[model samples]
Target: MKALIIGATGATGKDLVHQLLNDKDFEEVDIFVRKPIDVQNDKLKTHIVDFEKPEEWKNLVKGDVAFSCLGTTLKTAGSKEAQRKVDYDYQYEFAKAAKENNVDDYILVSAYGADPKSRIFYSKMKGELEEAVKQLHFTKITIFNPGMLERKDSDRTGEVLGSRIIKFANKIGLLESQKPLPTDILAKAMINSSKIKSNGYSNIKLGNIFCFAEKSND
Candidate 1:
């Protein structure tokens, strides 16, 4: 199968690309990014394009599965509109392109607590993206909602501190459902969910994401 990924430079996206390159199930792995990455593999293809100008590269979204992991934090984006551009506009554009190109499987990395009617901005944006993609009517759509991701070598102070707090809580047998999820495991679950033969939509929450990742290859 051919796999197309956005946000390949991110923590989860990096893990996903590595896993896809190593997995025998995927014959080709294509990544779209603003700049080129250092990794090289026979099955990997890199497309450095401007996300703001999708018309130039929208036709290149063809693949068996399209994984959308692009996201941004308010601190990094500097404004709500800027964050929306990356988290919602960019991902939605990619998904729209993939659907137009006839890609059947769509996998998304959404955050936990996402709801279209969410009072929080971040959750509302993610929820809105989920609804927008659903309107596209893909043959298969898998959305993963993970809480407090345990990114490898994460530099964000808030994320680091939050993860530590969650870890401590988990050790005390509290908030186990909110335990931080490793990026690699989430990547594995995304790939594994694509292999499922089901038609229509699937919403994999925090606990279910752990199970899917553990049983991915099975």
Candidate 2:
């Protein structure tokens, strides 16, 4: 199957791309990025695109399944509007194009506390994106809502400290549901979901995401 991905440069996105390229089930792995990457593989096709101008690259979103892992932190984006543009607008547009291109399956990496009525700005944005994509109505939609993702070689002081705290809590048999999940594990779960023959929407929450990662291939 052909796999399409946005946010291929992110930690989870990178892991997803690597796993997809290695997986026997996926014959083509197309990644839409703002700049060229160094990775080279026969199955991998990188499309440098302007997320701001989806009209120029929307046609290339064609694939059997599309993965939306695109996001940005408020610190990196510099403002709420900029962050929303990346997290909400860019991702929503990608999903729209995928649906328009006849992609039947869509897998999204959303946060655990996402709700359309969320009080927090980031959570609200993610929730809004979720709703927007669901409106597109793909044949199969799987939303992975992970908490405290344990990214590889993370440099964010607050995130690293928060992860450590969560790990300590996990060791104490507390907050097991909120455990810091590795990006690779989440990537595995996403791939597993796409392979499953399902209809309608499936929301994989924090604890369930771990189980999905361990699911045996058929």
Q: Which candidate is the best by lDDT?
A: 1
What's the TM-score of every candidate structure? 0.93, 0.93
10 residues in a row with least lDDT, candidate 2: 209-218
Model 1: number of clashes?
A: 0
Model 1 lDDT tens row, 1-218:
99999999999999999999999999999999999999989999999999999999999999999999998899999999999999999999999999899998888888887888999999999899988887887877777888888899999999999989989999999988888889998898888888888633344454635211211211
| Clash number for each model | 0, 0
Clashing pairs in 2: none
Q: Which segments of candidate 2 are over 4 A away from where they belong?
A: 200-218
Alpha-carbon lDDT, every model: 0.87, 0.87
**10 residues in a row with least lDDT, candidate 1:** 209-218
**Cα RMSD to native, each candidate?**
4.2, 4.2
